[model samples]
Target: MTYTRFAIYDAPSDDALAEFGATWLGWDIRTGCATDQPDVHGLDDITMTPRKYGFHGTLKPPFRLATGTDVGGLQVAVTEMAATCAPTKSGGLALTTLGGFLALIPTGDLSGLERVAGACVRALDPFRAPQSKADLIRRRKAGLSARQETLMLRWGYPYVMEEFRFHLTLSARMPDQDRAQWFQTAQANLPPLNEIYAIDSIALCGERADGRFELIQRYALTG
Candidate 1:
């Protein structure tokens, strides 16, 4: 079985996004239970792609372990890294369409978010297995830009550091009409994020035998 780790954040259980993910994805990573979907047209098919990923924005993209490194060692390193990093506060999140998909995006400066994510990519890199030829060829089919190719070759995933935009995906790409409707419904379903949310914790997640990712542990940003 292949194992991959991801650094992810969350929305409080009572939060709108929390419920949105539960209903849309059929499972809540936090509760680890199946959930009911909202009664909306094309909801099931539209969410099929991200449903497999559950919810939460990607920090460190998934990758297998490198030789000489194991989950035990990776856990220790992640814990230490979280302790040294400080949590960040953003202007809050807005539900909007990003590249034909629906997601929650930060409304203000994201320098702090960038720092934390970049650190995760760098500090835990030794644990990541290099991208294989198959992976590269598959990714290239998406038609990467020159910079994206560079980042992919270096980090195993293209979107990182300077290229990263923090977004918690709500749905996969859809037709314009579907995207518009979902955006409106999502804005209504998601809880109001008028206050500050501290990006203070990082959850360590791993893919299970079933191909679904599960939250293994969460480390607080102590610094």
Candidate 2:
């Protein structure tokens, strides 16, 4: 099971994108419910891990709050952060293979996206609980480099800073052949996100006891 984390996630801005994503992943973040998903051999297995988190790009990789911290205070901080950060414009979107898996990737203006993610990771870190020894050991098992180990110790997660890659995960690991098949299916069936899109909002999400993450709140970026 994935670690329980309080993450900043970029949720879909519209219902069409939301429904398409939920149907593809089989879990709706807005409703906290499972919905009808695509039917295909091994579709469930392919999407198992991502389905638990719903459709989101990790802005701040998950972390629990420090002792004596409260969720209410966290939500207030997120709202304040969004208020000062202007919305970002993604040049467009694409569907492609990312490390043996499928995800939605931004085409250009990535520097803007990077700023948003970095801000969240830095500004909200005061609330984050330190990584436990068990978690640190688990990350090392994934073969982190010296730089990655350094980032892990500093940020409580291995993939951050220069290592961060913004992706809205579509599936777990797949064979080369299976990846191609699903990519074709997704490109043909999912809603087209090719035109310019705005990163107008951010979502605060919390992991549940059952390992699924639930939407706590969504704050619009107003600046």
Candidate 3:
């Protein structure tokens, strides 16, 4: 099956670019891997495991399309979907700990963002391939809540709508002790958090044979 994902990307500013480069260099050294991990939050002891998928904040979860569903149709739907969603206002982002890893999550009320995300996921659901048995088992391994299970069955992903939290991932996962060190390192290296960041576009990404995600379409929020 073809692997694909839909996500919203923070358009990189000059500062963001430089910060990403520096953070990646540090993570590469810490992980002892030649290539930098795709997400730039930070790599700590807990999240040092290598993931085949590259980093991105999921907007619509990944799915393989049904046999006859064309890419052109999906593109049109995604574009239309994006055009109807309004951008987030007032709330800014902060580097915060999620479970075991540090990430940039929106601070304050984010019901608007969640609504947009949910609408996008639902709007595009018709084109998505039904989950395979293996996919369901893999999802079950995460020990989903009842609501998440309902979401999974209805929308092909568990984390959207009320479950959504906007975050740009930094690391795989890290231990509690290493968390402070990593957080400090990341805060020092990342772009300043005080700036107003926009969640104005969703990027369509595809997985390559080697399993890294590459950008395909970047749909702007026009609403």
Candidate 4:
């Protein structure tokens, strides 16, 4: 299949969490199909934003392939990079509201996760096409700091390396008054939250013509 863009993600390997995420989002990115969502009121509207990408934490943001690079070469580079990245563990995950949106975020020590994210951001960057001028303008509208601007220019994304915060989004930005209700729904529907979020593998995802991302491959961290 032809892909317009590619990204690296840390998708859930745990069956329960994976299933819950796929169902909740109404898209099984791993399987490249839509899922039957639960009949909860307003569930579809709230999840519309994150449904395209499925349940995963971003290791590297999406980018178009560079002029000379192809998916095959990209795969080889990812494999080689993964071989040098030892698996890392995090304190765990928690369902929380982040800047008005619901998400699963890591708690406690994040150094290991940070290291893995940093490595992915740097090592595979050669395959990333430079951000378009409009893209840069859109990013700057978020009021970037000097450091963020530098990172954006260098990495084509401002939120990488020191700025990276791993999260699995569960909903669109909702009104503050509606936050508690959605949070409760998410909690009730979710599997038991992880007590130890381990980074054992990373997935290569491709954006289909329909704009939904689908899992292409998962590379284990063996180093």
C-alpha lDDT values of all predictions: 0.78, 0.86, 0.64, 0.95
For candidate 4, the lDDT comes to: 0.95
Each candidate structure's TM-score, on Cα atoms with residue i matched to residue i, is 0.92, 0.94, 0.80, 0.98
Choose the strongest candidate by lDDT. Answer: 4
User: lDDT of model 1 at residue 96?
Assistant: 84
lDDT, candidate 2, at 197: 65
Winner on TM-score (1 vs 2): 2
Return the top candidate by TM-score.
Answer: 4
Badly placed stretches (over 4 Å) of model 2 are 1-4
lDDT (tens digit, per residue) of candidate 3 on 1-223: 2456433333333355424633443332112224543453444333444233334456776677766876778889888988888876436678888878777776777776677677777888878888888988999999999999998888777877788776767666776888888888767766556555556777776654545455666788887
What is the overall TM-score of model 3 with all chains considered together? 0.80
Candidate 2 accuracy as TM-score: 0.94
Residue-wise lDDT of candidate 2 within 40-140, one digit each (tens)? 77778888999989988899988898988888789889998999888888777788899999998888778888889888988899889998899999899
Residue 43's lDDT in candidate 3: 48
